[model samples]
Target: MTTASDDQKLASWRAFLLTYNTIMRRMEQEMQDEQDLPLTWYDILAHLDSAHRGALRMQELAESVLLSRSGLTRLVDRMERAGLVERHPCEEDRRGTYAVITNRGEETLFQAMPGHINSINQHFLQYLDVFDAQALLRVLTKVLEGERPAEGSQAEVIEGDQ
Candidate 1:
């Protein structure tokens, strides 16, 4: 039992997936070519920079960056060697480690930010009119808040409130 609305919804979902993959690849390639830095590294640096006192617990960072704990640990090891980040044993919680951004990390992020902003503007923002932008934001916010795309759907959206 196919319906026009269901077909349209599936088409929209496909479009979203395609656009996301395309934009991410472009962002990654541009970052690597221009800065000699991987997009994953940039993402970690940016997340760390935004955290309180430029630090976050390893688990929190893993969640923030959408990386598994083991994966993040390996990446953080590399970053530490590069002087981009440092791991400090938490005073209050000895078992927890905090990933803190270094001055060098901030410098790197600051340098990369302008190009990133330009890329986002060029590839994404320019396509959205004000109304479209607002609508997009609202819909995304709702989705992030565990909203169902269709009424009567019982699916759960898994997202942490960061």
Candidate 2:
């Protein structure tokens, strides 16, 4: 019962998955070599660093990271022990908590950004001209808008927006 268009779309999705995995692997390897941080940890730190007040509620962090509650809790435990982040009680809700980026985390992310950019350029951007990059960005924006809630910006995640 499948149409040719559906087959083509499936193929495109597969290709996108393969390319994304390959690029992520390369970026992860480079990040490990240059900064000794896992891609997930870096992702968390980057999100926190860019968040309003350099912090986010635990649930917001989990959603932004695309991680489960328990997974984020464990990740934050490790990060906290490493002095990269700290947890604070939410002002409005006693039972709630926020993950705040520590000075060390900020410094680490600042240091890692250049290498991350270079890896992005080497693995993906270098192959694309400006026009291609712009077009790709437009397409990606569409995809992101489909997946992201209205409140979350590409650069920062804020509460009460969605």
List ranges where model 2 is wrong by over 4 Å: 1-4, 144-162
Q: 32-112 in candidate 2: lDDT tens per residue?
A: 999998888989999898899999999999998899999999999999999999999998999999999999999989999
Worst 10 residues of 2 by lDDT: 153-162
In Å, residue 97's CA in model 1 sits off its true spot by 0.1
Task: Give me the runs in candidate 1 sitting further than 4 Å from their true place.
Answer: 147-162
Q: Which pairs of residues clash in candidate 2, taking residues 3 or more apart in a chain or in different chains?
A: none
Q: Pairs clashing in candidate 1? A: none
Give candidate 1's root-mean-square deviation (CA, Å).
4.8
